[model samples]
Target: MRCWCGKGNDTSVKTVGVCVRKDRVSPASSTGVLLNNAGFDYNVTRDRQSAIIMFCHQLNLSVMINANNPDDVLSGQNVTLDSRDIYLFSPYLVTNGRFSSLTDWQQKAVKCFNKTIELGIKVACQATSNSTIAATFNMTDLFSQAWYGTAMYNFDYFQATDIDLSGMTNVVYYFPNLNMNYGTTWQTPNVQTNALSTHYYRQTDTNTLHVFGDGLAYGNGTLTQP
Candidate 1:
């Protein structure tokens, strides 16, 4: 399930099946009546979580990180999260977790494909994909591709504990956004970028996925990007 976003390298982005009711496919769009796509209060955090879990069950799934490996949905571009990606103020989101310092940056986040039904493909194949589901995550959440679980700037910042790197290919890491101030102390770890067979990134318009450099979209023909 891939989409061609319009950007450098097409700046491809894959979105999730679950999303706010506003993005829902109205029943009027086709033959079926609107079911869960509307009348659900998705903006509420608690309802959002419960709705996701319920949708997951409907999709025949029970876990978030379904597997330990990346689906490699897009080109594994080496992204460096910097000031451009982060801001002093937070967005209007309720976070499940957070990483304030380097101590919490000594792990690896693997690939996950939890309820990632590509709506574009479904729409193309079928009339439309009514079984809607979507949820946004904080960058600090281990599940976020934006999360720097595996050191982003300095691998030596934290000591590794029981680790497993048995099955990984062409692993890439992110460079952190640094502020070389005169009297500021900054020590961040390298963030190992993991793959996600999801469209919840980079682009969101007309269901077109754009893939490209650093931020992630596509590579000439990466297994996932193509």
Candidate 2:
């Protein structure tokens, strides 16, 4: 017998069927197999792997390295004894030839799709900024574009690793009133000249953080002065 996925039976497992539990679809839905392991927990496969990997990635946020690599894992090379990484990764391993969940494949798909879209947007934004540059300045497109906007003064600083902002712009001008962590204590840096306007900023907002640049946001298409 064939499955709804249109694939012939496994021929090896006589009782297996297709699963359609509102999860685990495929790029080409027509060719995707929805195997039913009957009494399996899908989370044991997909969610646990992604969550653990993400947790490890987060714990090593300061190190700028991936901990799951076997070289870093098995050989003990490039491995830091980050207990957080160990605690996060160890529990997901298969025990006694069994796992607790099988829904991992769906979460894996979600992660892959999300990362692709995130990277594509960053590349597009950087490219758009580059195409607008005058070429003679020998400066980066991100820096030049910000200067031409209503930044007014050097209200920000951008290193490959961090960014510091000064002055007031609408996006952050309301920071002090937001009732958030930095609410009452927020203050714009006192910048001296307009020279700082030449720096490019990648600031994070409530939705996304520019992990590539100090977890800041890349302001929505450049906030302008009214």
Candidate 3:
């Protein structure tokens, strides 16, 4: 049977309510028993001292117990213990889960972002008007630039003309409707099919006319007023 200290064998015994010592046992043997019984299977090496310290700390062992014996405690080494090592050496410290490194955390974040993007696309497809698109945008507002940019680009295809450019002073044409084809050459109002489209007539600091289509376009006096 396993002892209370978590050691595999029953040869070692605990005394005085502390597992630090056994009946007439050497300090090294006692320390080994304490570590093994406590479920630590790592070797006591100079490089693993900090891990040992973390393990002991998790068990709430007295610091004096660490300092009393020099042979059991390896020295002359510096090593930083990360979450992975902490979990590996002493799993009781990690209640949530374990991440091996920063890369692991980043991968998890990417996975979550992908799921959010998938949901946002579904929301965008069902959006019928400016208000619905705005509401859908709010849902993906916290996503990264890449995800939101793609969402905005795809959303333009569905309701490009419904976008509200009320506060935009530089915007000359918010396009009365989404009839303009993507990547097609800009046409003059006289030759264009959609001539009745309400074109915004405004004078700005520059002659630049902003057209919001599949992608933004800029030109000087190309879009004329009816």
Candidate 4:
């Protein structure tokens, strides 16, 4: 008098040829086991199962128990989540995570990328400027190359004096218009025959003049033609 319990058998109605087992079935071995029984080949690891479940729950995705290859559908979703994590944690990605819209994220990404590129270029230029080839060029040329074709001049008097412009051709001087209330006397060279005297004078004021040996004067006062 052996009996069988068919899947479609109703417990309330006793059938002639079918019987029901009264003992309870144990729980599934693991999450993997449950997923496997539901026709998915998910890896039988606790962490992997937990990660997949949590990720799906966060995105409001349904974990269909009876679907074929349920884990395969999550492959792209997992990749997307990984990409987002990379962008969020990257050192170069500057963001407040408060995107008003999708276009806002796009604009921020472009700006960050441009800034990163500019920084890289500046670093590279600085390194190149320290090389031997840069030594052959003047400070102005090196500065122009490093700063993307912008010329930089030293405005300090000492720094300007340190630069040797003797080899440079076509030197020009600019002087501002000045008004002198009194006229000054020029020193006459000695009338020695066959002897040359080179004297340079810088006029500091309308009443005083300092003379040097062959150096141009920079002053703000008027000078009479020699």
Candidate 5:
């Protein structure tokens, strides 16, 4: 899937994540150059965000508009995470249990998988699972918070104040599509940003860390990077 690496000021760039939506896409930028330039072109430990920026730059990813789904983001990009990438889908998609809505046949990503069970099965089989469960746990944390916290409690009658993301752990969030004109129709909405960090001075892309202000992530102050 399409991945972005964002970390807190105190956190290092070890984990990568993705936000998924349903859509079709063809990447116009050079992924080869993105791979070539990422770690080599800049110091990931020092700048903390250069490689991610390069990824957005080369992939021509527009956080608000293009490639909104995990399937689309990963489409045609021959990359894999040693660890799994956390993918957050737009809440609107139906969970059909057929793998139809979540992923197309090309990628074959199903809705639920447990890294723990996977490891257990691998141990039982005496074979390497080649799979990691961090993504599933991370997704569970995300959905659990959003659901229990009533973040999207009343999807039809949404208010920015009702959404609470304070419970999230191990992942940083950026809601470029949080409001409607402030948000995109197929994107995130009404959910207030809890904490945001300076991962990239990026707009319309992920790995953008931090949330600011009256919890809605409003104003020019919210847009400032680092």
Candidate 6:
């Protein structure tokens, strides 16, 4: 396996060959001196198809390329490979599961996990005994609202007025509500009114310190409101 530093093989800089100058009588070929004087040299080589094949072999890697035409020759020498293009056959580091298609993998993996949870819940419900307790959890009030009340909800088919306090709870969220409801309440440290201090809040079941400003905490007995 390549070290985390990105070197193919962690080979020490041994004096492989001495560069002999015809004019120079004294041969100064010290490994430390050579390494110290080594100019800023990044692998500035654009590799063509053949060089890629050879490189893969040297690096103990397997790669595949379509070479039906005679024009398929190892060419260019750019040091870096395009992230978009993957070696068709070779399992390069980029294509090795994690970084490769991270979004797709994440979506699929989440779906798989959700499906597993659903299956587990279903199985638990079916095989429910006196000891087993099946519970359904929703993040309705636990999570923040998707849209800010100030924004308007519009689609291709239709467009409605700006988000109002019609379907929302009595408590005002981070966003402002345009249309006022009967039980419109504001949380502590309000932007406008300070008289209404008995605002509702939701606290995480596991933690009493972490409280969130919402109606669920006040309405559903999830949190203590002052």
| All candidates: TM-score | 0.17, 0.15, 0.15, 0.13, 0.19, 0.13
Pick by lDDT: 1 or 2, better one = 2
lDDT tens per residue, model 2, 1-226: 1122122323221122122221343334432221222111222232223322333243232111112221222122222323222211111112111221212311222332233333221000101221122323214323322222212121122111001111122122111111122122212322111232222222222211111111132221132211
Q: What TM-score, to 2 decimals, does candidate 6 have?
A: 0.13
Which regions in candidate 2 have their CA more than 4 angstroms from the true location? 1-62, 66-139, 144-222
Question: TM-score: which candidate is best?
Answer: 5
Candidate 5 backbone clash number:
11
lDDT of 4 by residue, 1-226 (tens): 1222222212232231122112221223211111222112432233333344344334433232221232332232232221111111011111111112222222333332333333221101111211122232323322222121100110011101112221233332221212234234423321111122222222222432221121122111122333
- For candidate 3, the lDDT comes to 0.25
Superposed by TM-score, candidate 6 places the C-alpha of residue 101 at a distance from the truth, in angstroms, of 17
- lDDT values for all models: 0.20, 0.22, 0.25, 0.23, 0.24, 0.21
Q: Write the per-residue lDDT of candidate 6 for residues 1-226, one digit (tens) a residue.
A: 1101111222222211122122332234311111111111222112322233333343333322211111121122322222211111111111111112222322322332233233221100000111211121112321111111111111001111112312333332232322222122333221111133222222222211111233223211122222
lDDT tens digits, residue span 152-193, model 3: 222222122112322333332232322232323223221111
| Ranked candidates (lDDT, high to low) | 3, 5, 4, 2, 6, 1
Local accuracy of candidate 5 as per-residue lDDT tens digits, 92-185: 2111110012112112222112221222110000000012223232233222222222222122211111012222343323322333222123
> Model 4 Cα displacement at 12 (Å)?
61
Q: Count the backbone clashes (under 3 Å) in each candidate.
A: 29, 16, 3, 0, 11, 9
Candidate 2 whole-model C-alpha lDDT, 0 to 1: 0.22
Query: In candidate 3, which residue ranges exceed 4 Å CA deviation?
Result: 1-43, 63-74, 79-226
